[model samples]
Target: MERGEKIVKRIDTAKEAKQNPSYFEALVELLFQLADDDFIISFRGSEWLGLAPHIEEDVALSSITQNTMGHASLYYHLLEDLDIGNADKLAHERQAVERRNASYFERKNGEGSYLQEPYYDWALTVVRQFLFETMKKVKLETIINSSYQPLADIANKVLMEQPYHLAHWRMWLKQLLGSTEEAQNKVQFQLEAAWPACADIIGLGPKAFELEKHHLIAGEDYLRKQWLKELEQSLSLPSSLFVDNHPARGRYGEHTADLDQALSTLSEVYNSDQKAVW
Candidate 1:
C-alpha cells in the first residue's frame, strides 16, 4: 500500500488480520496503545472517587471513569480475540515498561495518596482530561474508518459516549479558565505544564510506518493536525501552548515511576488471586 492509498480489503475477523505478520504486529501495537491509554487514565480518574470537590462532580467523575474503563476492556477483549492474552491479565499484569499510555496520563494525581491526606489537583485533572478527551475524539474519528472492521466498530461504539465525557471536562475547563484570577492562573499553569508532554499523546508510536501502510489508522501527522485544528476552534488557546517535545514516549515502552505505583495499586487484588477469574 502507498502512503495515501486507502485500504480496499476489510479485515472483519481476528483470523483474517493474523494471516499477515506485518498487519498483525501493527494491529497489536495499535490496540495496546489505545487500550493502555484509556486503562491508565481511567485508573487516575478512579482515584478521585470521593474527592471531586462536590457531591455531584464526585458521582459524575465516577460514572465517566467506569465508562472509560469499559472502553479499555473492549479494546483488551479485541486483543484477547486475537489470542494475545487474557483481557484481565492484559489490563492488570502489564509492567510500566510494557505500558503504552502517555506518561502525562500516568503522573500522580497529586502529592498524596487517595487513602491518605489526598491533596489532588483539580486544575490538573480538568486540563488533562479536557486535552486527553479532545485528542481521543480526534483519534477515534480517524480510526472509525480503519481497515480492520472490528476495531472500527469499537471506535464507533466509543464515539457515541465519548462526547459526553469530553463535554464534562470541557465545561470544567471553561468554567475554571473564565472564573477568578486564581482559578485562571491554576488552569494556565497546568496547561503550560502539559503542553510539552503532549507530543506522545497524539503520536502513533515507532510503528508509524507500518500502522499507516496497513491502514490501521491515519498517520500521526494527520492526527496531530486535526487535533490542533479542533483545539483551536473550541478554545482560544495561544499557539505557544502547543509544542513538539516529548518528555516521555510511553508508546515506545518508556514510562515513569508513577506508572509503577499506579500498576501496583491497580493490580493489587488481581495479583492476589492470579488464577481466579475476574
Candidate 2:
C-alpha cells in the first residue's frame, strides 16, 4: 500500500488489516474521524429533542439524531473490532484532546442548557445540519470503494439511509433561505459563523497522507472539491462561504471549551457506572 500504488487486495477483517502496521494505523485514524464526527453532531441534534421550531420539526430532528448516533456506533464498533477499545468507552470516556471530531460540530447550539432556558438557534441548526450531512454524504460515497471491505460495507449500509437525512436538512436550509428577510438573515449569519470553522470537518486528520497512500480513502483535495461542488450547485452558496481559516484543528486533536462541555454532558450517564451493561 505505498503511495500511488493501486489497492489490489481488500482487507476483509480487522485482523487482516493489523498485519500491516501502516495500513492499520491509517485505518484506525480514519475510523476515529468517522466515529467522532457523527457522535458529537448527533449529541447536538439530541439537544433539540423537544425544543425544535415546531412539533413536526421536533419529531423529525429526533429521528434524524437517533439515526446519526447509530451511524456513529457502527464506526465505533469497527474500531472495537480492531482492539482499540470498547465502543462504549471509546465514545463516552475519551477526553476532548483525544477526540477527532471537527470543532465546529462540538459548538453549543446556543447560549443555554437544553433542560433550562434552552435558547437554541434553529437557523444555526439548519445551516450546520445541511453542511454536515452534505459532507457526510460525499465522504461515505467516496469510501464505498475503500480498501477495507468492512468499512466499505458499512458505507453502503449507511448510504441507504443517509440520503434521506441529507434531504431533510436540505429542505430546512432551502425553506429558511427562501423565507422572509429575517429568516434569510439568520441563515446568512450562521453561514458566516460556520465557514471559518469547517476546515477541519473536511479534513482526514494528521494521518491524511497515510490514509490516501494506503488507499483507505480519497485525498482531502478530492473530498473538498466534491463537497464544495455539491454545495454550490445545490444551494447556490458563494464559494467564499467555504473558506478554511479556523484556528482550532480538531483533526489534529485541537478542540475548544464547547467540546469539553459536550463531553461532560454526553459521558455523564456512562461515567456513572463504568461496568454497567447497557
Candidate 3:
C-alpha cells in the first residue's frame, strides 16, 4: 500500500451519502441530469403520441413514452431520498436554468403544435430516440457499477425496460434507411442534425473531473469512447460527429427557450394550485 493514499468507500445507502457530503452532492447532481433528460424527452414523446403516421407505431411508441416518464420518476425519487425535495416537486417545480439535462434532449420536435398544424417528422423521432438509448445503454452500464448502491440498483431496474426502447428505434431506423431513396435521405438529414449534438449527450457536465475522481462514475472520456464505439458499429458517422459542437450544454445550466415551452406544458396540470387532488 502507498503512503498518503486514500481509500474510497462505497455508498451503500442514503445515510452513507449524507455522511460523505461530496458523494451525496455528486450523486444528486448526476441523478438530476438523468431525471431531467428523461422527463423532457418523454414529454416530447407524448407530444408525438397521436400524431404518428401509422396507428400501430403510434400505440407502440406511446408505451415507450410512458416507460421513459417512469424512468424519470425513479431518478427523481432517488433525489427525494437525498432530501432535495419530493419527486413531483423536483420534476415539475425547477426553473429551466436550474435543469441539468443535456440540451440534446430538449430540442423541439418540429415546426408546430402537436394538436394543430402539425409537421412532425418520424425520422427525427427515430434518430433521436435510438441515439439517446444507445448513449443511455453506455451510461447505465457504468452507473450499474457506481459507488452509490441505490443508483446502481436503479440502473439495473431501468436496463430491464430500456433495451426494448433501443431495439424499437433501431428497427425503425434500419427499415427507413433501407427503403426508398427519399426515406433514406430524410433519415440521413435528421441524423446529421443530431451528429453535432452528441457532444452534449456524451458530456458528464462541468463536474466531470470531480465525478470521476470520486469514483462516482467513469470519466467523460471513457463514457464517450464507449458511446462512440456503439454508435459507429450501428450507424456510420458523419464527419460532423467528431466535433464537440453543442448549441447549448444543459449540464452547465444552459438551456434553450424550447425548454421553457416544454416546462410550461408538462407542469401545467401539476402547477395549477399545487395542492389540488387529481
Per-prediction CA RMSD (Å): 2.4, 2.6, 2.8
Point out the higher-scoring one by lDDT: 1 or 3: 1
lDDT of 3 by residue, 124-175 (tens): 8888898889988999998887888888898999999999999898889889
Give candidate 3's TM-score.
0.93
Model 2 C-alpha lDDT per residue in residues 31-86, reported as the tens digit of each score? 99999999999999999987888899889999999999999999999999999999
Q: How does each model score on lDDT?
A: 0.90, 0.89, 0.86
Report backbone clashes per prediction.
Answer: 0, 0, 0
TM-score of model 1 (CA atoms) = 0.95
* Model with the higher TM-score, candidate 1 or 3: 1
TM-score of each: 0.95, 0.95, 0.93
Specify the poorest-scoring 10-residue window by lDDT in model 3.
238-247
Model 2 shows how many backbone clashes? 0
Looking at candidate 2, the ten consecutive residues that score lowest on lDDT are 233-242
